[model samples]
Target: MSRPMNDPRFAPLNLALEEALSRGLGSGFALGVRTQGGERFQTCLGLAQRVPTPEGLTPKHRFDLASLTKVLLTTPAVLALAAAGKLDLDDPLATHLPDVYQYDPNHPVRRVTLRQCLTHTSGLPAVEPIYTWGEGKARLEALVLQKDWAFGESVYSDINFILLGIVIERLTGQSLAALAEEAGFAVTPGPSLAVATEACSWRGRMVKGEVHDENAFALGGIAGHAGLFGTLDAVLNRADALVFGAALPPAARAAMLEKQTDDRALGWQIRHLNWSGGGLSSARSVGHTGFTGTGVWADTERGITWALLGNRVHPTRHTDVRAHHQFRQRIGNLVQGIFAN
Candidate 1:
C-alpha cells in the first residue's frame, strides 16, 4: 500500500526547508514530494507577506511559477497538439504565423520552427527589453519577430518560448489561459490570495496574484515564457502526470524528455551539476525553475516528483537565489536517502 503521508525520516527535509525560510531565503514556500510507490510528503513554511500585513503560507496559496509556465502550459500544449496531429514540431513558423513572418524584415523568422523554439536553438536572444521598447503587445511581438536568428547552440531564450506561446495561441485560436485549462491546468485565472512576488516599480506595488515578469506583463500576463500561477497541488499534479505517463502520450513524453540540447529537454530543463533539482536526479529527470522562487522536478527513473514554490521576491526582486539553490540541494539529498534501498 502507498503511504499518502510523511514518514519520520522526512523530518530532516522539512527542517532544512523551514530553516531556510526562517533565514529569509524566501518569504514562504510550499513543498511536495511524491513517488510512484505511494510515498508522499508535503509541508509549508513562512509568511506570504511581511511588510503590510502577515499572511501565513498555506498549501493553497498560488505561486507566481514564472518560467515553469513553459513546462506547465506551453510544452504540454505543443505535445498534445502534436499527439492529436494538430501541429508539427518541424512546421515552419510561416505555416501558422504567416502574417508575422511575411511582413518582418528579418527573413530568419520564416525558417524558424516550433522545434527550434522548444529546444532554444532558434537563436532568439536570451531576453529583450520589449516591455520598455514598445507600447503594446503587437509592437512588442513585432519587435521579436524582426530579431535575427543564429540557429546553432542552445541559447535558453525567453523569446523562444514566447514565440512558442504565440504559435500555440495562433494555432488553437484560444488564449493560452484557455488552452491551459483545456490541458487540465490553470494560469493566474483571477484575483486570489496568491503569494506575493516582486514589488516592482513597473507595477509600483507589491505584486500578488499577478505575474512578475515584465515582458509577460506587457503581453497581457499569458505568454509562453512566464505568467503562470498555481497552488502546490496543481503543480505537483502536473509534474506527476508528466512523469508517470498521465499527461502526455508515450511518444510525446519521450520526445519532451529527450535531451534536445545538452542540458535541455523540449520545454523542460534537464539536470545539470548545481542545478535547482540538485545532484540526486538521474539524467532523465526533467524540471524547470521559476524566477519567483518556484520549481518542479521529476525523476522518472526513481518515480519522484518534488515541487518547491515560494515568494522569494515577495517585496523585491533583489533576493539572492543561492540560498534557494542550496535548500533544493539539501532537500534533494534527503530525498535520495529516503528512496535509498
Candidate 2:
C-alpha cells in the first residue's frame, strides 16, 4: 500500500499548511503529492468557508486555477499542434491570425511570435480591463489586435495567452474549452468545484465558479489565458499523462518538457534553477501558479508533484498578505523532505 498523508516526513508540510490557514492565509486549501513511483501524500485544511461544511475543502475540491489555465489548457494545445507538425513554435502571429496585426497600423501584431508569447516576451500589456468594452469575440479580437506589440522586459502578460488562445481556436477550429475537454480535462460547470471569485465592478454579480479573469470571462469563459477549471485530481491526472506520455507520444512529451527558453518549456514553467513557485524541490519541476491562491508544481526529478488549491480570493482578493506565498513554500519544503526520506 502507499503511505498515509500524515507520514512524519510530511509533518512539516502539514504543520505549515495548518498554521497558514489558522493565520488566515486562505479560506480553504487542498494539497496532493505524487512521487515518481506513484507514492502519494495528500492533505486538506480549513473549509470552503471560514466556517465548515460536510464537503469541506478536500484534495479533490477544484479551485479557480487562475493563470494556470495558460499552461494547463492553452499551452498544451500549442504543443499538441506543434507535435502534429501543424504549427511552429517560431511562427509569426501574422501567419495564423493576420487580422490582429491588420487592425493596428501603428504597431503590427504580426511581429509577435508563438515563442515570444510562451516566454512572455511579446511586449503586450500585462493586463487590461477588456470587460469594459462589452464587445463580441470579433470586436474583442480587434481590440487585442489594435494593442501595441513590441519587445519588453521579461514579465508575464495575459494578453500573450489571450491572443494565443485565439490562434489555437482559429487553427484548430475548436473552442478553447472544447479542446481542453478533448485533451482530457474534466471541466464542469463553475458552481460545481469552484467558489465565487469577485463581484466585479463591471458585471455586477458574484462571479461564482466561472473564470474570474475579466478578459477571459469577456471572451466567454474559455480563453487561452484563463477560464478552464477542474478538480485537483483531474488536473494532476492530466499532468501524469503528460509526464508519463499517456495521451501524447513519448517524443512529444520530451519536446513539451524540453527547456526552450530560460526556465520555460513550450507550455510549462520549468523549475531547473531557483525560479519561483517554491525552489529546488521545484527543480525538475514544471508547473504553474494561479492568481487566486492556487498553484501546482511537479518535480520529475523525484517523480513527485503537489497541487495547492484555495479560494484566497474569496470575500476579497487583496486581503491576504504573504500567507499564500509562505504556504506554497512551506508545502514545497515539506514535500521535498518527504522524498528525501
Candidate 3:
C-alpha cells in the first residue's frame, strides 16, 4: 500500500507544510496521506526541537499524540471489548468500573452510560485539576467520580476517557500501556528520538518524549485521554482501521465513524460547518486533534486519510488557536484536491 517517494502530487503538500514551518506552526512535522486504494506518501520537515542542540526531523520521530488517544486508543478499545462480550456500549460506566462512587448508588456518576461518555454527553465538566489535588493516580482518578461539582449539559471531558480507562483496565486486568502497545502505539518512545513539545515550567525542563498533559502525566504517564506517543505511520494505520479495519464488529466500527451525537461520533468528530477538516470534507469524514498540535482525519467517502504530527507547543502553547485551524483547513482542502477527479 506504499507509493514511491517524490510523487508529483505530494509537491503541493510539501509546499504547504513548508509554509506552516515557516509560520512556526511547529519547529517540525511529519505528515502522511493515504488513499483507500493503498497509495501512500509522506512529507517530513523542520527541526524536531528548537532548544538544546538542534535535531532535524525525520519520518521516524515519534510525536506525543496527546488527545488522539481518545479515538485512536480508548474508543477502539471500548469497541473491541464490546465485541468480545466484555461489556456493552449502553451499559452504565459503573457496570464496568464498579468503584465509580460505589458508596452511593444514587450518585449521578453511576447513571452515566458508556455510550454517553463516548459521545461526550456524560454531564461531566470538561476538565478538573485532579493532578493538583491528589497524591496518587488512584486518588486523583477517584476524585472524578466522587467530586460534587455542578454538572450541567454534557460537555467534552477528559474524565470521561479516564473513567473509560478504568473500565478497560478493570475488565481486561491489563495496564493501558500493555493494551496500547498491542494496539500499535509506541507507548514509551525514547526521549532522544521523540519530538519535543514544550518547555514545561512544572516539569522544569523541555518536555520531550513524555506526555505534556498535566493530568495524564500525573496519572503515571498513561490515560485514556492522553499519554499516547506514536509514529506518523501508527496514526495513519489506526485511521485506516477506523475506516476499514475488520478488527471490530462492523456495527461497532460504523458507530465509531458515524455521528453518534450531534456532530460527534464515538470519539471522532464528524465534519461540520467551519470544522478544521475544512470545506472539502464530506459528511462521511471524521477527525480529531491533539493538544500537541497533532491531527488525523479520514473521509470514507473520499477514501483518503491524512495525519499531521507537530510540536506546536514547543517553547510555549500561548499562541492563537484560530491560526492552527486556518492552517489545518488550508491543508485539508488541498489534500482533497488530490482526488478531485
Candidate 4:
C-alpha cells in the first residue's frame, strides 16, 4: 500500500514532525517506514542546520549516526564474521586482538569475550578519553587494557565497542568504514546530501558530514561505538535488510536478537515501555538510538521498520533526552497508525 502524496491518513505524522521541527527539537528530520507487505514510505523536512545559513534536509542528506554505529556497523560485522566461521562470539578478545591486550597477560580484560563486549557486561567504564591518553592507536589500546575489568552487571560502555572495533579490524584486516560499506552503509555523501550536526566549539565550527562523538572524533572518526553516517533511505534500507534476512542468516539473526542481558539483544535494545519506540512497540520490537538524535526500530513479528534521522544536537550538543524520547514515541505511534491494516 503505497501512500500517495495527498494521503490524509498520514497527515498526523506530517503534522507532528513539522511541529517538532518548528519547535527546534531538531534543525532537520527524516522519517522512513516499511510495512510487512514490503511497502516503503519516506519523508524529509526542515533544515539541516539553522545557523551558518539554513540548509534544507532531504532524503539524500547524510546524518551523523552517533551510537547507532554500534548496532549498524560493529554488531553486523561481528555477526557476519561469526557466520563465516572466522570467529566465535565467546572467543576471548586476546585470542583475536592480542595487540590490544598486550599490557596485561593475566588481566581480566584478557578473558573478556566478544559476547561480553557486545552485551556491555565487560565491566569497562562508561567512558574514558582514550584519545587523551596518547596520539596513537597503541597507546589507546594499552590504556584500555590496563583498566580493571568488571563483569556480571550490564552497563552500557563505549569502551566495549571500541575494543570490538579493534577486534573486527584485527580479524578482518579492514577499517570499520570498509566493513560498514560492505554491510550496506552509504560511506560518502555529495555536498548537498550532508546533514549538519553540532556546532563543535573544539573544532570551531558546525559538524557536517563528520562524526560528532568526541571519543570517536579523536579516534579518527571511525570507532566501534560511533562514527558511522548515513541518509534516511540508506538507514532504512539497512534496517529492512536486517529484518528481512538479507543482513544475517537465520541462525545468526536469531542468536543476535535473543535477549542476552539487561533487556538488550546482542547489539540491539529490546523495546520496553517509554523507550524510543514508546507504547507503539511490541515485545518483538528491537531498536537502537544515537546521541545525535538518530534511531531505528523494527518489529520482525509485525514486519515494520521505523527510522528517524535528526540533527538534534545541531547548534549545540545538548538536548533533553526525555523530549526526544517522547518525540520518538509519538512518531512511532503515528507511523504505526498510518500503516495499520
Candidate 5:
C-alpha cells in the first residue's frame, strides 16, 4: 500500500510555502515529501503562468529543472556503465576521448577522472558559451578534454557533466532522453506543463517548452548537464528510487549512495557537516539544485525528500535575485522541521 499523507510535522512546510507565495518568492511551486514510514506531503501553489490566462501555471505544471539534470540523467547512466564494468572512474579523460587531449599535451584535464567529474573536482570551468562556438559535439568534446585541471577545488562545471553525458551516449548508443524514459519518467506532452526561461537574442525566440540553458539548447535539449523537461511528479519518483536505492538491491543502493569525498557519492551530492543555511542537510541526504530555481533533496536519515519546482527565471531572469537564496534555505528549514516533530 502507498504511505499515508497526514502528519503534523508537515505543518511548518505548508506555512513556509504560504509565506513564500506572500513574499513573491515564486509565482507557483510543487513540493513533495515522502517520509521514512512512507508518509507523503505534497503542496502546490500560485499559477504556472503569471498572466491570468487559460494556460497559466497549475498544480500539474512543469518547471525547468536546470542543473538538476546532472543527477537525473547524466549520473544514472554513468552509474549503470560503472556497474557493468564498461567504464572506470579512475580512467583519465584521454582514455575515452584522446582527440581532446592532443590539442595540448599539458592540458590539466587529461588527468581528470570520471570520479572527479562526478564530484565536481575536475577543475574545469563551470560554464562556457559553447553554443556560440558553432562547433558540433566532437569539437566541443575536444575543447573540454583540453581544459586545465584544478583538482581539489569545489568548482562545479557543466562541461564536466556534459562530457560525461557524451561518454554515456557513446558507450550505450542511447540518448539521455531514452535512458531517462527507460528509467521511469514520463515526458510532458505539448509543452503544456513545461515553462519558458528566457527570450534569447541568439535563438531569436522565447524559450519555452524547450531547454532554457544555451549550451543544452545548442546540444538539442538532451545533454548530460542539462536540458530535459517533465512533470514534478515524474522527477520526484525517480529521485526517490535513486536516493533510497529502493528500486535496486540493498548492496547496489549502498554503493551508489556511499560517500566518496566530503559528502559526494557516485552521482548525487551528499550532505556536508558545515553546510551554510542548511544546504540539503542530513547524513544520507542526496539532491541537486538547478540554475532555473529548481531543487530536490532527499534525506535518507529521516526517510524524507523535498522537491521544489519554481520558475524564478520567468518574465525576466534578472528580477530581484535575493529571493532565490532565501527560498532555498526556507525550503530546507521547512523540511527539517517536518522531521523535528
Candidate 6:
C-alpha cells in the first residue's frame, strides 16, 4: 500500500514480470523492499484470480507462503526452543521425540540431529505423498518418521521440517498454527485478503483462502512444511529481524547463521549463483523460497529486506515454476542494482 503496484519506480522490474505473466507465469505479483534506513517500496499488479471470481493482486493480499513456513514459522520456533534451553541443535530426534523410530530402538534415524534437519542434511527424501498415507496429523507424522529413510548427502526435504514441527509441538505443547499466531506472523486459515491458488484436481475447486500444499491441507492445513498465509509485511518482518538480529538472543542468532553445509545455514540458504537470491547477492546474505511462488531475501551487509509474493500457482501448479525462479533471481539482481546505485 505504500505505492501503487503500477508505480513507475517498479516499471523496469515489472516489465520483465509482466512478460512472464503474459506468458502464463501466474495471475499477479506483489513485492516489498525495505532498507535499514526505513525506506520502503512496494508494488503489485495483475489479477489475483482468473476464475470463479476475479480479483486484482494488492500489496495487502495474503499469499499462501508455501514452504516459507519452514523458515518463517518453524525455524523461529526451533530457535526459540534452543534459546530457552529446551533443546540443543546437536541432540538427536530421539532426544525430543523418543517414539520417532520406536519400531527400531537402534534405528540410525533416531540419531539424526536437529542441526542436520535444519541444514537439510538429515538424508531424508526430498518429498513424499504424505496425505495419501492417511488422515490426521499424528498418523501422518508417524508414517513420515517411520518410513525407511535412505541415507545420503544433503537434500532439501519437507520431511525435515515436518518432523521439526512435531518436535516443536512436543516441546511447547502448541500446534504450529498457535505458535504462528503467537509469533504474530500474520498467518491464518482464511484471511480476507487471501489470494487464489491452484484449482486442485483432488479438491475439485479453486484453492483460495486455505492451504495449497496437498500434504499440508491433508494434515489439517497447519504443518511444519507448508500452510502459512501472510502478506508482504510478514516476510519483510522476518527479513528485518535477520538483518537487525534485534529479536533473537545472541546465541540463537549465531546458531541460526552457523554454516551446516556448503550452501546452507541453519534454516536459511546461503546466497549462491543461479539460486533465487540471485548471483549478485553478498556472500553473507541468506534467503528462502516457497512453493507458492513466494520468497524473501535479506542482504545483511546492505541491511535490506525484500519479499516477493505472487500467485504463480493460481489456477494451477503446472505452470513454469522454473520461470518463476528466474523472475525471483532477476528481480533480486535488480533490487541489488537499485540500492547499489
TM-score of 4: 0.93
In the range 1-341, model 4's lDDT, one tens digit per residue, is 33433477778988889888877789888888888888788878898778888887766678888898998889988998999999999998888877555766877778888998998888777787676666666656666665665554557999899989888888888988787777666443433668887788877877777777877777766789998888777788887787675688988888888988657899898976577887766788899999899999998778899898897888876777788888998998887677655
lDDT of 5 by residue, 1-341 (tens): 23333466656766777787677666677777676776666777676756434245555666778787888777867777777788887888667767556768667676678888888777777788888866576665555555444454567788789889878888899877787678654332245676656566777765667777888777756678887675677677778887775555555567778888886787677777533225546666777778777888887777787788877776567766666766777778767765534
lDDT of 5: 0.71
Q: Judged by lDDT, which candidate is best?
A: 3
Clashes of 2: 2
Best by TM-score: 3
| Runs off by more than 4 Å, candidate 1 | 1-7, 104-106, 147-153, 189-191
- Badly placed stretches (over 4 Å) of model 5 are 1-11, 51-54, 103-106, 135-154, 186-190, 246-252, 273-281, 320-322
Cα error, residue 141 of model 6, in Å, equals: 2.0
Clashing pairs in model 4, backbone N/Cα/C closer than 3 A: none
What's each prediction's TM-score? 0.92, 0.89, 0.96, 0.93, 0.86, 0.94
Model 6 per-residue lDDT tens digits across residues 20-101: 7798877888888886677778777888787777787776788899988988888878988999999998999999999887
Local distance difference test values of all predictions, in order: 0.79, 0.72, 0.85, 0.80, 0.71, 0.82
| Order by TM-score, highest first | 3, 6, 4, 1, 2, 5
Give a tens-digit lDDT track for model 2, residues 291-329.
877788777777777777777776567766576776677
lDDT of candidate 1 at residue 113, scale 0 to 100: 85
Report the lDDT of model 5 for residue 35.
69
Candidate 5 colliding pairs, count: 5
lDDT per residue for candidate 3 within 123-179, as digits (tens), equals 888988778887678877777666775678888888889889888887889989998
How much is the lDDT of residue 316 in candidate 2?
A: 65
Q: Candidate 1, clashing residue pairs?
A: none
